[model samples]
Target: MVNLIRNENMKLYRRWRTWIMAALMIGAVLIGSFVDWHYDNKDAGADDWKTQITQEKQHWKEMIADPKTEEGSKNYAKDQLAIGEYRLAHDIRPESDTMWSGINGSAQLIMLITLFTVIVAGDSLAGEFSTGTIKLLLIRPASRLKILLSKYISMILFGLLLLIVLFVVSLLTNGLLYHFKQLDLPLVSVDSAGNAIELSMLGNLWKSYMLNGVSTILFVTLAFMISSAFRSSAMAIGISIFALFAGAIIMELTQPYAWSKYMLFANLDLSQYLNGRPYQDGMTMTFSILVLAAYFILFNFVSWFFFTRRDVAA
Candidate 1:
């Protein structure tokens, strides 16, 4: 199993697309950090912390009072108000455009990693079949299960490697662009009671990165299942990507229906729990986790069954 995994890893990393994806992630970090530094420098002396918070608080209050505001928007503003007030009370100034801020900001780019990984997952099995390499793989000593499992494991590791690279590069590039003076600073977050609590900067960043993993895992599993069930890499990749985006749109369109809460994409983003919000009123973190786990199991069952039972000669 170890040798099989190693072989799969080698095959994955040796591809030119793998290196190109890494370069794109590194380049994104550099470019985003540079832009952030430029803007932070411009705003550095524009207003004092207290003044900015005061204006922000006033804006939130106005948003709440506005009749045209949506329920979600008002709720979001209320959460922002809680955090903003906590920052003011604790003096956790606007994250100071530092390396740490860059690291936190880079969390947004996790979707890029997801996109790359989905393509890799969707292609892994189907591409082998498309190129007539699956026969060679099957003739090896390893069982079909081991080969498929090894490919899935390697794909996951590839995604993790990209994530680590993003964090490290963001830390280094932003450290060089700005400075690492705010290493001791703590992040302010709202607790369950809508009160602000201080959280370690590193702790918060890790949580943010892991929250992103929820979507990555779900969609990658979808791509993996699609790859195993189909012979065309293009079909697998295209359908998976479409579903990823379409899920969000469907959720938006079906917000009024109670059944929307049960949709796979609706529960994929666990980040909503971190901020004390769910897409719907009755949803919870535990519930979302259960839903995701159920789908994960279903996808894996279909992938394994179809991959093992079907004849490659077709």
Candidate 2:
């Protein structure tokens, strides 16, 4: 099993496309940091922040008073108002213009890693069959299940590598752009009682990173399942990516319905819990994790069944 995984990893990294994806991931982070440095490097002292928050609160109040404003917009303003008030009470100036803030902001790019991982997982098995390489793989002494498992493991490891690359590149790029200050800053969040509490910086970052990583794994497994069941890599990749992006829109459109909470996308964003908010009122972190686990198991079962039972001819 060890040798099988090693061989699968070798095949994965030996491809030119693998390196290209890594390069693209690194390049995207660098470009993002450069743009942030060019546009958003203003220093905000306490008075500056107090003035800015006061202005924003006034603007939100005006928007709330307007009858023409949408409920959603008003709700967003209400949340911002609460946050602004919390900051004022806690004397927490907004996050400083520092590399740590940039690094934390760059966590939003995890979706890009999801996209690239989807492409890789979608092509992993189907591409082999399409190119008549499955026969060579099948003739090996290893069982079909082991080979399939190795491929899946390799695909996941590839995703992990991309995540590491993203973090490292963002750290380096932003560290140089904004000097390495704000390392001791705390991330503030609202509690259930509407009081602001401080969370450790590294704790919050890891929470964001791991939550996003779990989401990436779920979508990657979906693409892998499609790849195992279909012979065309293009179809698998297209359908998986479409489902990923469309899920968010669908969830938003159906949020009023109670059944929407059971949908896979509704539960995928565990980050909502970190902010003391869930997509649905009763939704909790444990519930979301359980839902995601069920979907993960289902995807893996379908992949295993199709890959091990299907006949491949070359």
Predictions: Cα RMSD each: 2.5, 3.3
TM-score of 1: 0.91
lDDT of each: 0.86, 0.84
Which candidate gets the maximum TM-score versus the true structure?
Answer: 1
lDDT of 2 by residue, 164-233 (tens): 8988889888877866665666777656655557778777777788998898999888988899888779
User: TM-score of the candidate numbered 2?
Assistant: 0.86
> In candidate 1, what are the lDDT values of residues 231-307, reduced to their tens digit?
77898899989997788888999999999888898899998887656899999999999999999999999999989
- Which numbered prediction scores highest in lDDT against the true structure? 1
Model 2 misplaced stretches (Cα beyond 4 Å):
41-47, 50-92
lDDT agreement of model 2 with the native: 0.84
TM-score of each: 0.91, 0.86
